[model samples]
Target: MTPAPALTLARRQALINRTDMAGPGRLRLVNAAGQSLVSIELDQPCGTVDATGVALTDTEFAQVTTTGEVAGALLEDAAGERLATFTAGLASTIPAPELPLPAAQLYAGAFVRLIGAHIVCD
Candidate 1:
């Protein structure tokens, strides 16, 4: 597993958690090889790092559960370009909010990507 990167850009801390619709919604980044990356269980408006900069699918959201996984290509968007990392037998333990409360959910076989702070190019 890779280490947590330091927040360097202003947008790093500015990233807000995004939530998908309860019934159906887009997962964002998709793998061209046609494989499920991760799956996140959301019951309420769970905050997520949404890079698409698009509108939320549904404002009505819920909290994440331990049984869920965030499936999809975790990407790092830097300088307007999205980056992909190798997940070959690798698992990352992201710093989740906390236990015993409304927080993010993660499980085995979950896929994730790391994004940098800067969205602009030098």
Candidate 2:
């Protein structure tokens, strides 16, 4: 049997993009009640810069929520190992802004290429 691929630190924000949120799709799984959830749309691609890059549009607000259950799900097991048991935390926008141009562009495209609107979980 093929070994299961090891999960890695993946950047997949496009999965939570606005367009995706606005359409019919899988309901985010939940393990708690009354948690906070937030999503943000940037005026320019906050993660991508350059002619080939994508900037977030300001027309929408970058959402922030107290609910972090969904965010917790996206994190790889290894990535979440350092976090405390509590799941309350804000998911930051794409990290590409903190990276160099080439890295940023690649990450930006990854962030925006999701089938629907992309969002950072918090």
lDDT of each: 0.28, 0.26
In model 2, which range of ten residues has the least summed lDDT? 99-108
In TM-score terms, which candidate is top? 1
lDDT of 2 at 74: 22
Tens-digit lDDT track of model 2 for 1-90: 532222111222342232233332221211245332332232323333223222323333233334233322221122222111122222
Question: Taking the tens digit of each residue's C-alpha lDDT, what string does model 1 give over 1-122?
Answer: 53234433223334322222222222222233434444222222323333322221232323222334333333323222223322222133343211111222344443433222111110
In terms of TM-score, how similar is model 2 to the real structure? Answer: 0.20
lDDT of candidate model 2 versus the reference: 0.26
Give the clash count for each candidate: 19, 24
lDDT for residue 87 in candidate 2, whole number 0-100: 29
Q: Of the candidates shown, which would achieve the greatest lDDT relative to the real structure?
A: 1
Error of 2 at 6 (Å): 33
